[model samples]
Target: MAVLSLKKSNLPSVWLFSFQVIFLALFVGLKFQTGYDWPIYEAHYAAIQRGESFYLDFEFGYEWIVQVASRVGLAFEQFSAVVSVLEVAFIAIAVRHFFPRYCLVVMAVMYSVPDFYLIPTFSLLRQGLAVSIFLIGVCKVFSGKKISGLVYFTIACSLHYSVIGGVFLLGLVYIFPLSRMTFSLIFAAAVVLYVASFDIIRGVVEVLIVYVDPKYMIYLDRDVFNASFAYRAAFAVVSLVIFTCIYSAWMRRESSDGDHFDRGFGLLSYRLALLGVLIPLIIFGFPTLSTRYQYFFAIFVIGCSLGALQYVNYASRIMVVAVIAVTAYLPFYRFLSSPLSIVYIPYQSQLFYDQTNSTGHDRTNDLLNQLDVLWSK
Candidate 1:
């Protein structure tokens, strides 16, 4: 896609981007006893404080962070705040590096996608940190720093094993470039396979269980796969993948070949975005795996979408932005209507809200009531 021409001295854009980075860091960092996984994280923190051994399921890097925080006498809230800041900082670094002129717009597109921003930032702490680091590594790799990129990728995988899939995908795309037509064929085949291979996939997982960590079996739980929310989420991801595919194709055709960096990086983004489409379709039966793994590529998909924006006129750009905005909002609306919405509905800051209070208890009860209603349906 054509690059947006913004003045280098656009002070207002820079300032606005700065404010967003600061606000996001503070907002997510200071959140108190909210988010889906806060209770689990809090329990882990408490275990560390009691001098208990680290949970085997958690990555070594994450355990090290918890251990360091516990030894330094930092509370769970404070530790979380630090991690949150690092996450936001890494994300900002990547955004500014790759899309300096349209950093704000690119960031807006990222934040609009809940899986790319909200869920990762607020709930999936370890994977989120790893993804953020991996994003910077992607920037380095695209800039021709292979050794540095490998180092970053290693560190990212150390934080979350889930990053291995992403790293593998990146390496595959980098080493063996595929045409857009090949990607389309693969995407179509994946959809067909997903429609017909549920039992086959289940059998494969069962066979691998003996060799894999027992903890990962939760990803195959029937309850998770059968949940109404899972279907809704899968639908949203598939829609996003299709949208990204279309725009990325437009970007490749409309963009000029004069800028080597833009052309090369844009092509990489396009290929990765196509992989993002295939991920969901290939793993449709494994919702958790599909959702968690897709985000790694979704980052590139967002880049493709934003890059495509440059090829369009103002009216079409506005229309594309509107579509992106609505795509972002639908997931949030679905979450609000779900039983677990109570976990995040009213944002609570550690500075002002007491999680142990009756208000918190009421929210918990409300959540239970909603779950009962859902299950009884």
Candidate 2:
């Protein structure tokens, strides 16, 4: 572990600290938001409060946690925000030791990237917590702390067994030789298997069906999606480009710096970059399946891209800003224009409550006044 020193605590850390403060507040400040799956969450919270047996359909651990909290009468918004806080805290803790230079960048992308935030933080609540834990576990694994990684992975699996298959695949990829030839073969083979004829694909799907939870089997129909496949495909290509650039830079640095540079994360980044491509293709034919898997891939792309941003040097150290901008563009565009924009648009907060009701007062002032309350709570 590295020791803290005032000499080492410089401008970048100060800037990152400021960014963390603002980002944490923005992310965790939801005040009864009304969008994508909020109705479902509200219903569940209500049921829990009313002492009804619910969420029996989902993971037991998550269900129990929410039920217990609801029994104690916590506000849903505040409780959900606590989950977000844990998500950020875990990631920050992992990166603080391993990727100090890029911790803020990773945290920034993990929160700000549109699809990443929209899907996990705003919609897939339990899975959001799981994925955050999963990423922390991944960081530990890549940092050579396999035992710690296993602990995190185990907790995540308990929350959402749905993504355990993807995690298995990631483990397989990671244990394989970290060479260009091996990666090429894996990527090519995955693409071939995914793009094969319908009969062959059907056989593969049948095999996967047996292993998948029976609950998700209802989403197996192949006719539930279209055009959006192209969108995900394009996003994958963009991710690939960004990852490759960062990876190439990392390789150069590793060659110069020898064992001092940890390049495994770079390798992991590109591997996920490829998965970003493969997942869209594999799930494209079914909207249900696509959405079921969206949470995993969104994390892959955002986490990988943000990790890579550490090695990237666009405009010579302005790369973080560039990466942040690029990370936000797609999600922001979708937030405004997509048919599903209702899932993420119309940002909500108690600060805006008065203004939203035409009270004719300053939202900023309201927010400022409530800051002490917010922090104290």
Candidate 3:
């Protein structure tokens, strides 16, 4: 929780800063036809352009963006770029406000965790934007601007209804202000439930079905629970272990010149990280819910993990960073080598559009075709 001065010497090196800028530029300017969900969104944009009815599958804020972009005559690529810029801007603002000295480290850690970066920004576009704005709201709330935080949370939920879960969790945490020990006990219980293969959450989901939209029932389909459950559960557990190490080191360090607000924010972040880890286990049967919501909490996990680095001794810091780097890299490498890599690898940009030799576009089409075949089966 120590607050480092914003001195030039304390900032990230020029090379690191330049690399981040360049990487962000490429990320924002990504080709519209390359990402996993781009085709669906592009189709919706085309529908809007053709004067068709707006796609109700997405939330109103996203539909509004499409309509405005279509009316303005912007290409789908341009619209996508605009959204990416906004997403990055929101994330940058939040990171700078909260962890100014660790901006590079935070970005590095986030990138290392594919779900935190690639899956969200490159695939779940609407949810990505919502999460980014939600992060800003978290900053506002922690800074004592509760009303402004509420407004941001409202807008985020409007953009992606799935974000309502995150809002609800944030509200619970703010009101109750759980201690680290409570989060640990909750996480341990969740892990036990997951290990037992308990379906208690099914009861909760069934109750929700009565009050929530019927369309959401699709997520409860038996086919949704597959081998990915174990994989995602393991991932969450590993991340929780990593967070426990960082937090323990943070807790052991002597108190610094940090005020009550700084210390409180760190504790809050640790609790949020614990909540993030518990989420996948708490909703074990719902694979889609586990996958999507974990990323929402990962924003906090990454921040809290990196922020705690300042408090640890040099040896412990190095060890934690090394573990994080390895853990982060393994998933990233596996992702790029996985069959799903067709959706993201061979990165393409709108700046170099080619009608005949669009490898990325062609690969994405092939992947989507395979998905259609699988779904039909």
Highest-scoring model, TM-score: 3
Give the better candidate number (1 or 3) by TM-score: 3
Q: Give lDDT: candidate 2, residue 375.
A: 38
- Rank ordering of all candidates by lDDT, starting from the highest: 1, 3, 2
> Which should have the higher TM-score, number 2 or number 3?
3
Q: Give the TM-score of candidate 3.
A: 0.83
Cα misplacement distance, residue 101 of candidate 2 (Å): 1.0
Question: TM-score: which is higher, 1 or 2?
Answer: 1
What lDDT is reached at residue 45 by model 2? Answer: 77
Clashing pairs in 1: none
TM-scores for candidates 1 onward, in order = 0.82, 0.71, 0.83
* Candidate 3 stretches greater than 4 Å from native: 1-9, 13-22, 55-57, 195-199, 206-213, 222-225, 228-237, 253-266, 333-337, 359-362, 372-377
Can you write out model 3's per-residue Cα lDDT over 1-377, one digit (the tens) per residue? 11222223466654665467457846755655677888788888899899987455788788887889899999888888888878877876676676666676676666556667777888788998999899889888888898999999989988898888988887787668876667777777777777667768887888889688987776665424443555556656575666575466446532453455445555676677767767767876886677688877775666666655666565676666677667656546556666756887777777776566677667877887876765666
| Candidate 2: residue 265 lDDT (0-100) | 61
Count clashing pairs, candidate 1: 0
The per-model lDDT (C-alpha) reads 0.72, 0.57, 0.71
Q: What order do candidates take by TM-score, descending?
A: 3, 1, 2
